[model samples]
Target: MIFSAGDGKESEPSTPLPPPYSGHNHVGDIEFHEILAGTDNFDESLVIGRGGFGKVYKGCINHGENLVVSAIKRLDPESSQGASEFWSEVQMLSRLRHCNIVSLIGYCTHEQEKILVYEYMPNGTLSDHLHKQGTPLSWFRRLNICIGAGLGLRYLHNDVGIDSGVIHRDFKSSNILLNESWESKISDFGLSKTCPTNQLSTHVNTLVKGTFGYLDPNYFRTGKLTRKSDVYAFGVVLLEVLCGKPALEELVDGEWRNLATWAQDSIKEGNLKNIIDSDIMGEISPKCLRKFVKMTERCLHDNTEQRPTMDAVVVTLKSVLALQEKLSMQAAGSRTIFGRMVDLLPFPTNGENSGRVEHNTLAPSKHGDGIVVAVKMLTSKTRQAYDKRQTKHIAELAHPNINIGGIFECRDSKHKYFNQLLFPNRGNFAEPLSWGTRLMIMIGVARGLTYLHLNKVHCDIRPSNILLDEEFNAKLEGITKTVTKETHISTWVRETMYYMAPEYFWNGDLSMKSDIYSFGVVLLESMTGRKAWVYGHIEKASLVDWASTVKSRIIYLKEIMDPRLNHNYPLQGAFECFDLVLRCIANESKDRPSSKEVLQTLERIYALNK
Candidate 1:
């Protein structure tokens, strides 16, 4: 009665049905003609789910003497998910049976036709309910659904009674289905794989295949598949449920960002209330919210070994649910004061104003350990724009040289603000800097820019955007703007023309190289201690043009050095650094050195001089 997809070499012949279903039953084989009739010629009206694999159709089937509803999935022959994937699902679902796991009714294979049938889920997918359908789910409902899904995963990884564990390679909200009673069931086992049973090996090395935002970074990088991969994806789903946001969001500003990055940043800064779905805000107890956030953080640990098991996740979720239930029973008058603390913050006056930057001190140790932090309120308009601009780029661009900031929500105006580490002597670059200190700052800036470019395309690079700490270490702070490969330079060049490349100015093309051009201007300004543009006899003069003219005469390079240095600079390093600045500002965008190359050259110069 058991069916095998047949190891990609050949399709196994259809097997006969097992004796009347007890608890676990082999997947039944139905005729393709019957499947076609049930689906009504694969009509669009019957289609319920469409994906890369194919279309899922709602259909009716005869089980025993009674008619039953079922979901019929028809494979697209042209899809990359071929016979191997189709069979994989059939084999996996046949042996797995649980209340929270989708049930397989039967399958049909005739000639080239490959189809699967499953118990019909009347309410559709969790993704549909959470995002598409206007009916917002209550906090209680979301928590219950997550708990059920977690239990199902726990069974897959531990209680399945199988020596080799199951790893749901593609676990996300969309793969979770809801029956008529709104009971959650984990579905779509096509990408599921069995982990190694050997005691010595912890994971199975395999090809990396999963959704973009939900893919585990460790798995994606190392190609090691384990149960923890599912944990990472489930963590993303947890964030989606908590925030009521998509796993991957394309903001109004045209940048694609991950919700996990946004959630991590918000939680770290104790601004968890800001990112929560407005509908569920104040409904969750602060204690429960903190536990939920902590669970997500544990699940998303960069190291797979450090991530919690599905069993651990289920226990934590139950604890949170219990806390929520307890808080729900308490009278409003008797509710804990800590739960209402976030609501008592001052109203935010900074709404959509880019020019104004306000600093405030938050209450001590609300979420993280007791350490006072500084908060900078950004306008709601800015938050809306920033949310769309791939906040993950900022989160992932963590380095000693990068001024990474946390995000939070303002209680009064419901505006979101960034919480940055406080440093004394915060000011513009116009302040005096020694030649050695300037070189160190330039190198730091190059390293930070290099990291950003490796992870994302940062189009904004300028001296004003660079902040110096007490020790004069440069920390970059600016919007990490990302543009598509097809994005034209002219789209954003108008707003930042001073540091933009000449090619971008003329042809309207943008790339990572564009940032190098801007970096050149920053380097020139930092060297000469002058503004991007200065007044001359005729009109305004560009820093790039001035630097290029000075470089033409090697001797004038020293004269162009910042007057504040007072001829106390290292001559060899100064000349080499200026040479790099000239290369970065090349008129032909392609002629510019890459950020990595700039970092390497700067490091070599610094080492040689030191």
Candidate 2:
């Protein structure tokens, strides 16, 4: 039979599927021999699904004399975060040996590629069996899958091999794999982290990570991650199993809502008929459905602290299955954070990933290049600010010998997955710049600044608004540096605090001479390998003050050179740079050299090194 949509014509699937397995019927052989052997034999031809980090394939691995078929995941090298996630999964799964949890037999990272071997689940993923076009599972089996997955989660949260205090940041149906015996295993630990038990708010301040539909709204707003975040995600997954709907979708009202909200609204109105999956209609006992919904409601409670623990959730879900007891399932409709409605709402964008296959927009380059580039994508607010600044301020910019390259705004591209790129020759900070490169950085930055200051436009400078390419070349990356009218008193004061000339800090005014003062700070940072603000004994902090005091000591320069660059820095070059820095940071901004003179001096330094 075929399905039809609005057009009334038989609608074909966008993609076709490979034929089912014909060679091997043995579950163990399919897992161990053909798959886990970790060969090219098991490639995309056997792939079952693709996700943010990698693709999942079906194969078999050799288990001694016996062959076991299994599922293997391959991580793409170009994936923005593939390497870190691959190792994280290895660390979490390799040590864990449990019945309910999926077992990690072996892994391989060859030629900048990663592959994970796991025991094959003939029954496929829980999401597929629950929502896919296949034989509908009995309510008993569905509940069994839930309990089994919950057990696996409980073990991860506590019992596993160790109390590493693991937080499975991403938990959903697609991640739950099922075996022939119908037992479930929770997989995917890419976002998982091991933290200290003493930590109070499981919510750590981190960059926003996780899928759109499953992400904890609270965690997204505050950047604070907690175990309750997982509970919220699990609640969504439970609703998916119960209702058989995608997490988020555009409804008739034009508002995007997830399964949790839909289920909640239905439960409140006593409209289970419309909410429950048609396949399991009339089969699930009223008592079981009520209990299960209550379990989901507890998991979805807005107050993460008030939500049942994974341990409690497991017990409640199990009791629902066995005792068929009814639960009150009362959840306050209006939760705090009403103001965050705008944030919780999903916005349609060109490129969005939900731990699934990328849209395949960017094509890979055929030629090999030594250089790699990294670009950070900013929000619309940041972009708009940059645009306004670009037209008003053609800021004068120059600094030490750092080289700066052209500034370009990034747009969504097929090659650009997350609208960010951190490439290797495009810039290098992990390794120390060589002495020759250091001199080049100084001269180049000075030249860029010389052009800016000489341009007749007033410009304010800050170090963070600077850029360095792979060759240690520095350039000004700010939208504006020049000023015509009296700059805002507050804005000038803030800028001065970071790279202020002594006079500018005391009284908010900036000039070309003041630029020299900030340049001195940059020079010191490059020489000493210390950040502008290092946490000191108790009170004092400031890179310039620290460097000045250290420069007076006999052994100071040696102490400050980056260890990665080795100890063989030329003394004459060092003294020249130090003298240049001291001149720039002189008591008065007027005494500082013009960027033109600074460039001349750095050019001499660069020549000397060569």
Most TM-score-accurate candidate: 1
Report the C-alpha lDDT of model 1 over 1-610, residue by residue, as the tens digit: 1112222332322342222323366578888877878988888999999887789999988766767899998888776676767777887888788999999988887777788899999988889977896467888889999999999998888766557778888899999999888889999887788775444237866667778789888887777778999999999999999888888988777998788887898666534434667567546655576689889999999988889988899999999998777656542212111222322223222222123222222322132333222233233433344453445644576687665542222223222111121111346344366666667887888888888777565665776556665566676665434565454322121125567665554344667898899888887777787766655653344666667667676556667887767787678888888889989988788899999999898888777667
How high a TM-score does candidate 2 get?
A: 0.46
Task: List clash counts for every candidate, in order.
Answer: 6, 62
Predicted model with the maximum lDDT: 1
Per-residue CA lDDT of model 2 for 415-485, tens digit only, reads 22100211123354444556676666667667777776655423445545555544445555533334533
Candidate 2 wrongly placed segments (more than 4 Å): 1-44, 64-66, 161-163, 197-201, 250-256, 324-610
lDDT of each: 0.70, 0.60
Determine which window of 10 residues in candidate 2 has minimal summed lDDT.
Answer: 329-338
TM-score of each: 0.52, 0.46
Whole-structure CA lDDT of model 2: 0.60
| RMSD of each candidate relative to the true structure | 18.4, 25.3
TM-score, candidate 1, is 0.52
